[model samples]
Target: MKTQTTVRRSKYAPSVVTKNDLLELLNADFTRECRAIYAHAVYAERTRSRDEGAAARIARYGQETVLSALVLCELIYDYGGTVINNLDELNAVLNADRVADPGWAPETARRLHERAGQLRSAGEPGLAKRIRRIISAKKGAVPLAALVSGQQAVAGR
Candidate 1:
């Protein structure tokens, strides 16, 4: 079985993404999902049984985040995009404060929704729907936040 891969094949990636810019958006979404994985893991750890039920839920969310990443990898592979293996890139930006803070969850979910919409417009309705469902189900894992008035939230913030 041929298991190894490298950037040499990146040039083979399809250019169908040009018009819809789906790949770029998906890449950004993947990054956010990765950050969520890290953040949620921290949440699970620090939650410390403040509420036994809530703690279990938080830990489950971390698991869901892992699942999302797996699905995302499949999507990338299907679309002829390169899979990102260096998670350290994600870890570099996620600081102790951000990991412990649940505030980023709502924003993360929003970005995923936006990407799913783009995926649909780009003729990827099934993938888009899958993304939506995964995101919706994981909302509890994400911390709820009140939207800021008179300001649009920036992605990956």
Candidate 2:
């Protein structure tokens, strides 16, 4: 049997960054310093929790998971730079398994995706690309798979 592929366009066209752009950003001294600091803090927090086993406790109870999800939602909403107009759509998009397990409701996901697309169109290329990748990875529709594959191919891996 033969299969055909179809392309689906993002509702908004946001600028995207090349690997070179990311490399350049990473190579900057200021950026390196900031990254180092962030890494250190993350490590320290994790290390300190090791003694009390708070990390294990949190993980066992799902507190960390819940907090992480909340943080993700806030970060996406803030960075997407647009308010999701349709709660239902947003839930659907977020709930799609490819994007997340026990995902956001379909409506929530759709709204989030729409907002993320708007951010992509607003010159926040990196954030937009991240959102697009998240949605694509969730494996919802054929168009998304095509786009993800196309991206991987372009990356020459």
Q: Best-fitting candidate, measured by lDDT?
A: 1
In the predicted model 1, the residue pairs found to clash are: none
Model 1 weakest 10-residue run by lDDT: 144-153
Q: Tens-digit lDDT track for model 2 on 71-157?
A: 344444544332222224434333332422123235334644654555555556676565555455434432222332343354454
Query: TM-score for model 2?
Result: 0.27
Q: 32, model 2: CA deviation in Å?
A: 33
- Supply candidate 1's per-residue lDDT for 1: 54
